[model samples]
Target: MNIDIVCVGRIKERYLTDAIAEYSKRLSRYCKLDIIEVADEKTPEHASAGVDRQIKAKEGERIAKHLKDGAFVIALAINGKQLSSEELAAKINDLGLRGTSHIQLVIGGSIGLDEAVLKRADYKLSFSKMTFPHQLMRVILLEQIYRAYKINAHEPYHK
Candidate 1:
């Protein structure tokens, strides 16, 4: 199975990028892992809540375009399901057995994901109730994915 992480903003921090890349490399042994960065919307001063939602909605559309047809989409949200590493591995294995060719994991920007994107996702996952920056979330997601693969393969890296 192939996994793709689609995030709204670029990772500017070198350390964060390096960390994500390292996990990506480790996950490649199990499945193809790719990170896709989308342009973030610029919010002007005194922007209304409605305006902000519109901008986030547009960004969500751009993310939707990158998704492959028939791929299972998973959106990272604060209110989503929180799964353990072992559970995540089982979910991945279940998807694989179900013949899911691609899995798209989406990370929204500062304001969070649009309602449309969340509605479209096959699964909504939450790492924690406390909010995280989008850049850091990418790295965390990558690490979790790597750990999941390790668990699935009975490897020692997950410990």
Candidate 2:
């Protein structure tokens, strides 16, 4: 499987970066994982709805550009469906069985994803209803993907 993570903004913290790298290395046994970081637009000092929309639009364009052709796109959003680890493993295996080998997981910036990106998604997934820092979400996502792989293989990690 080929997994691509298109995320807005870079991971500035060393600890987070290290953790992500660890997960990425661990994931190599299961699939090819690539993480693409896009530039995040600066929020205006006094922003309005229009400004926020414009920012999301710019970020969305950048995010969409990195999407792989024929890949199943999964956008992370607050209102997305919540699934258990076992369910996620099942979904991943099912996608592969159905011949959708490439999977693109998108993580938006602080303000969230635009409507266009959401519309293009094959599925919307939510880790939690509570808010998390975008940078931290990257690591969390990688860990989950790794966990899914373990579960699919009937490894002990899922327990």
Candidate 3:
């Protein structure tokens, strides 16, 4: 299976960059994992709701650029479906056997995803209802993906 994580903003912190690299390496044994970091939109302090929507739209456009044809799109959102590690592993396994050749997971910018982008998703996943920094979320996402693979393989690492 081929997986792509498309998100806004680069990982500026050394620790986060290192952690992401580690997960990426681990995931490589299971499938092709691609990380695409788009430049974050600038949000001025005290910005209006309209301005915020525009910012998200711009970021959405950039995220859309990395999407592959006929790929299954999964968006990470606060209100999305929350699944356990086992369930996520099952989902990944089922998807892998399905017709799709690629699975694209989207992590939106700080303000969240544009409705237009969310509408394109085949599945919306949420690890938690609580908020998290975009930078840290990337690391958490990668870890979960790696864990899911282990679970699917019935490897000792999952337990």
> lDDT of model 3 at residue 93?
90
* Per-residue alpha-carbon lDDT of candidate 3 for residues 12-41, written as tens digits (9 for 90 to 100): 899999999999999999999999889899
Clashing pairs in 3: none
- On TM-score, the leading prediction is 2
Query: Which has the better lDDT: candidate 2, or candidate 3?
Result: 2
For model 3, the stretches where C-alpha displacement exceeds 4 angstroms are: none
lDDT for 31 in candidate 2 is: 99
Clashes of each: 0, 0, 0
Candidate 2 wrong stretches, greater than 4 Å: none
For candidate 3, give the lDDT of residue 129.
Answer: 90
Model 1: per-residue lDDT, tens digit, 1-159? 889999998888999979987998888789988889899998788889998999899899989899877999999999999999899989988999999979999999888998989999999999999999889999889888888888988989876
**Which of 2 and 3 is ahead in TM-score?**
2
TM-score of each: 0.95, 0.98, 0.97
